[model samples]
Target: MSRLEPLTMPVPQSASPATPAARFHNVEIILPRQESQAAAQMICEVFRAANDLFPGAPYRTHVRDLATQMRSAPDGWKPRTAIFLGGISTRWTLNSGEKASLQRICRQTPRCLFAGSAIFLLPETGLNTRYETAVHANFAAAAKEEDLPCAPAGTLTTVSDRISTAISSFAALRLLTTYLREDRGAFIADAVCDYLGLALGPTADHSRVSLQLRQAAGGDALIVKILELMQRNIEEPLLIRDIASQAGVSPRKLERRFQEKTRTSPLAAYRKLRIEKARQLLLHTSLPLTEIVAATGFGSRSNLTEWFKREYKTSPQAFRKQYYAEREPQRSLA
Candidate 1:
């Protein structure tokens, strides 16, 4: 990975030392009508975690619809930062009114972030014309056709002036962490990254279990694909046969490969992944046990409780309570 340049907010030269900064910074996340709610929820969760860690709730986040915003102009309220998420289809082009509204928003906002196919909007809004934007491989040809200044292939993210662009979900998370580090201190940013299982820099640490699983696979494409499938289907796990079929292998061969490489059965590995996910949600989120059970593919409260206790040697509620109790001092210091 290339070295990431520091992300800094441009300070006004006229500001004196005695000038007080705003207590809270407002962030606006704009989504297209057809876009998934997942991206918007992810952005909001980042800020929500930050607010819990910070004393003053430094970041205030809001979500808005792009179509609605274009139809009705913002009532003289501009956010400190505006983030645009990619839509389901990049085939649609912006009309005159939408383009004008976006241009005005980008001009007024102090910082703007474009993720995935949203980079195409830069040309239409006349923003980031001078910057080399990180374009996703899927959208690179379309971006170039639209006259976007695409960065070199495999470039994850780019920050130029007040604008930042990220090509993929991982890149977007990194970019968001950089922005958080810039706004808050490194401590707060690192804390959020750790909670989200995100790495701050190229050499930063990631989820240990995940990293170990990948390393154990030893670059076997089949095992890697199976692992990815398991991770993606955490909320609704696939049967071992279905998983093997999707990976283009027979169930017996899949089990043999797993035993040879990781020394664990496919069913056991899948159960472990789901339990790990449940543990993370228990620690980081305030969702109820029923919700966590549902989210982790556990069939019922009793079933999840049984498996969770077997793995962790403690009940889920007890674990969550103890974890937060242990972190109380750290929260106080923050």
Candidate 2:
């Protein structure tokens, strides 16, 4: 009878393959974001940390922010300092290892930081919202949940971007304020809302089910349609509002559904979609950074450079130099 008690315990192998699982992990690290002068050492420390845990782990991208305006950040850039996840295991795939190291920095997860801190969940776009740039260290880890519509990046960086001075949103404005930062949760919540608005653009939710049952209980179709549209037009530089319109819903409705389903908004999704495309472009092309910026709808070289600096923490030129270009020298030496 005592032995029988153990039999009821579900073996690890018995777990359903489809169940969203939590990756139980704890991480603590300080990313010095504005310390680009020490970026090389930081890079080494990050790799060492990763190797310490998962040996022979296939590494991805080393995203860096190369902003020179460390003392006074650009209009939307300051205080937004933070790090790319320095050491974390990406969901392992067959080919990821083969492409590991500096040569393919374009397609890997960027190891990013800025202004002596790491920014979490910063959009790769040129604009920075009233989100708290950073005051403390950021923490993030992967927790798998029921499948949600994802960008072609096929990934999400669920993280906490530290708030130095928080602000609230009245409707539309990316500027910062002190009121929001006082209440951390509310600030984060507001940031999420703003990003969602960006994602939803002007779409509406046509969720007939929720309306039929609980007046606001329907969202599956809206979510599904939005995902499909995003996937189909992965290459286009469309706005979140555009995605909402395609779903036959208003931006507000679509944003609501996105919030309900994925706990994030459509604008974040759109930004990520474009960032993922840029990632692919970085991996596959020898195109100049300016050309890449234009191709990815990043507006101008300076803007794209700023975004790249904030999102990945390195200038595109440095990234290409370390990963893609320098390899030839190594080969020649060998």
Give the per-residue Cα lDDT of candidate 2 at 32: 24
Across 1-334, the per-residue lDDT of candidate 1 in tens digits comes to: 1221212222223334454445458787776655555667777777776665443435666666555544454466667888887743464356676777788888889999988777777877765466788988888778788777888998989999899988855577787888888887565677667756565344333333444455466647787788878888999999999999999999999999988988888898889888988999999899999999999999999999999999999999999999989989999998
Candidate 1, position 163, lDDT:
91
What overall lDDT goes with each candidate model? 0.75, 0.38
Candidate 1: give the clashing pairs: none
What TM-score against the true fold does each predicted structure earn?
Answer: 0.53, 0.33
* Candidate topping TM-score: 1
How close to the true structure is residue 87 of candidate 1, measured as C-alpha lDDT?
A: 48
Q: Supply candidate 2's per-residue lDDT for 98.
A: 22
> Weakest 10 consecutive residues, lDDT, candidate 2?
1-10
